[model samples]
Target: MRCLYLWVIIALFLMTTCPSAHADEAVATQSFWAGLSTKAKFQGEVVSNLVGGLASGSVGNALFIGGFSWDSERAGEWHGGKVVINFLAVDTGNPEAYVGDIQGVSNLTTVDSLMRLYRLYYRQRWGQVTERLGLLNANDYFDNAGVACDLLNASFGIVPVLSQNLQGMPTYPFSSLGSMVALGGGDTTLQAGVFGADAVHPWQQPFSQGVLMML
Candidate 1:
């Protein structure tokens, strides 16, 4: 699979420059304003075959993902901001997971493993906007009438918002809203945000079919 997308671009360039080299020792401590912040990311993608030809066909199909993000700022007084954890480490190849046999199921193997957590939240910023509930893996909110687009920030561009299987068509909506967009500049800095709508149950109904749009 193209060497897992070149090791996810060298693990996103070492998690965006290794945290600015410790950001000056975390700004000289002092309870660091309630410390505890960690982030990690790695991505990969590859798909080539032009059309398909070669016995079992398959000239391209690769993916490598690694993720980790944790926050815990001001952890009291009904909690404040920060307290998230994200995870992703997939390898599409269809060993039985990826996507093969249409729907037959047979432990395929070759594109990606399929495991995402788009965002696990607990943020707070009520003033200029910054509200995160919890349990997020797909559909990072979406409400056209109000004007929202927070599919886990990436400067508002990660290209994810399509779900409709069972004949509906769309597809590619699971795996936590098909997340994949973290390639900015350097010094590492990638924040994420998505809203809610599933009302809560029914397996979160694909994150309420999109409506909140990054609160």
Candidate 2:
């Protein structure tokens, strides 16, 4: 784990010091997509087993996400409203699939070969409250801890109670037609959302067979 942390520092150092390695690619991409309301991020990692569990091998995963946000005020559509559409492509395989581990090796390998429309939602902000509707993920809005997400364990990222009990609460790699409402001020905030739930989600079925009430 220390090695992984060291590697991260070294990689960041290289990215800052070795600008020549990626300068051309960055310039080319920027020039090609000069005037656009879109941004893309590429994130991936390969986690190799260093000790005890899950075999002495490696599993790799990558997530490439691209999104376009349209501002209602700028686009002259409506005031205080914005629409964002995102696409996520996940290429991954779990190490636990081959050799079982209690906590798994990496969070990236949790889902594999998934190409989906991750989030396509419209949010309207009015005063101190914001309302979001459309295809969305629950993890995007609820039960988030900034520091706990720093670790590599998947268990640390999500709530164990919700993950264990909720059938389909509009989370990662998949989403449902849900509405999220957030209210409050600087120090205190309250968030609540309603989503569709089923034994199997209807991302494939497309709302034909699911109940739209998950508390």
Candidate 3:
């Protein structure tokens, strides 16, 4: 957790240190903006609860998430820089369902939560290529692998394999580096690299593991 905090601090530092220039056009600029988004998710769990003698268990676990997003955009021309902060608190029937549950039980519970930040460093356009960089959300590319693959394979209507339940995924509340380049007049975008997963802790192992593939 301390390492993650340090990475976030570094990212903030870089954002502040980097030089920025406004475009030749004047437009509305907001130093800060606050908003909220709500999401509901369902998860199923099959676990064993240890007892003095034998054991007990349950299934059909569910989860709910409510998030708050804060964004700030610097005034610029067609391309501008931005920073975003996201926070999420989940309601699981049994907190133990999560790896770092508030409670020690490995049962179904609601104490698990996720937080992340999706920052935009800089954006520039040259002909057909538009490039962007900065701390970003892991979900921008990794959240639903199957869904992304499906989108890339839109010609066929086949749905890919998916896991019904998820746990221990890193809640980046702050990821370090990200860069993307678009091609063919906005028809496609190719992402190059990203950073910050190394700072994730064991509690966030699931999410961090997925980032390894991003490289």
Candidate 4:
């Protein structure tokens, strides 16, 4: 994870240190944007013994996300094309291990404590229709409600009844190789996708485990 962080920092440094060009030239050719964010949480078990055993404890952890986006129109390559690269880094410890909550106390909490590529996708749009290929997160397009945007519980972010039962839903913490297409514009639009069933390391096996399609 440290190595991954170093790489991201170095890349950002290089981008920022590049020779300065006219603002119009930068916008007419290509544009790059980078961002880094971290969320830390501490959860303690006050009362338990009903679900994950009679043990009570507390755990603290953090989630780090850093990435960059490149736009074709902004980069002056083409129109309606963009590329995104994102990475996820989880600190040691799982909050659910202490809270023993099925819904999860923190939405950012995950079992894995490592750094990995989270999203790497390219999108192209033609009028009202758009196509995206490569790694993806299903929740970003489906079952997403503005009302629950700030919720911390895992179930609130994505309905557990569906996300939990699905073998590879491709929500958070885990992503899969997939392709998505959408038609229409304005307030009404239609989207459909086919994603790999393997939650972890889907790129290695592709859709060997099967596929999950969403509409």
Q: Please report how far candidate 1 places residue 197 from its true position, in Å.
A: 12
RMSD of each: 21.0, 18.6, 17.0, 13.1
RMSD (Cα, Å) of model 2: 18.6
How big is the positional error of residue 148 in model 4, measured in Å on the Cα after superposition?
2.1
Looking at model 2, residue 127 earns an lDDT score of 85
Backbone clashes per model, in order?
A: 25, 1, 12, 3
Deviation in Å, model 1, residue 150 alpha carbon: 28
lDDT of 3 by residue, 1-215 (tens): 99999999999987776534232112233322222223343444444454432334432343333333332222222333333333333333442433332323322233444443334355556666656555454444444344433213212211122111223222222244545555554435555554344323432442444543242
Better of 2 and 3 by lDDT: 2
In order of appearance, the predictions have TM-scores of 0.28, 0.71, 0.36, 0.71
Give the CA lDDT, 0 to 100, for residue 172 in model 4. 76
Worst 10 residues of 3 by lDDT: 155-164
Candidate with top lDDT is: 4
Question: Higher-TM-score candidate among 2 and 3?
Answer: 2
* Worst window of 10 by summed lDDT in candidate 2: 206-215
Candidates' lDDT values, in order? 0.40, 0.70, 0.39, 0.74
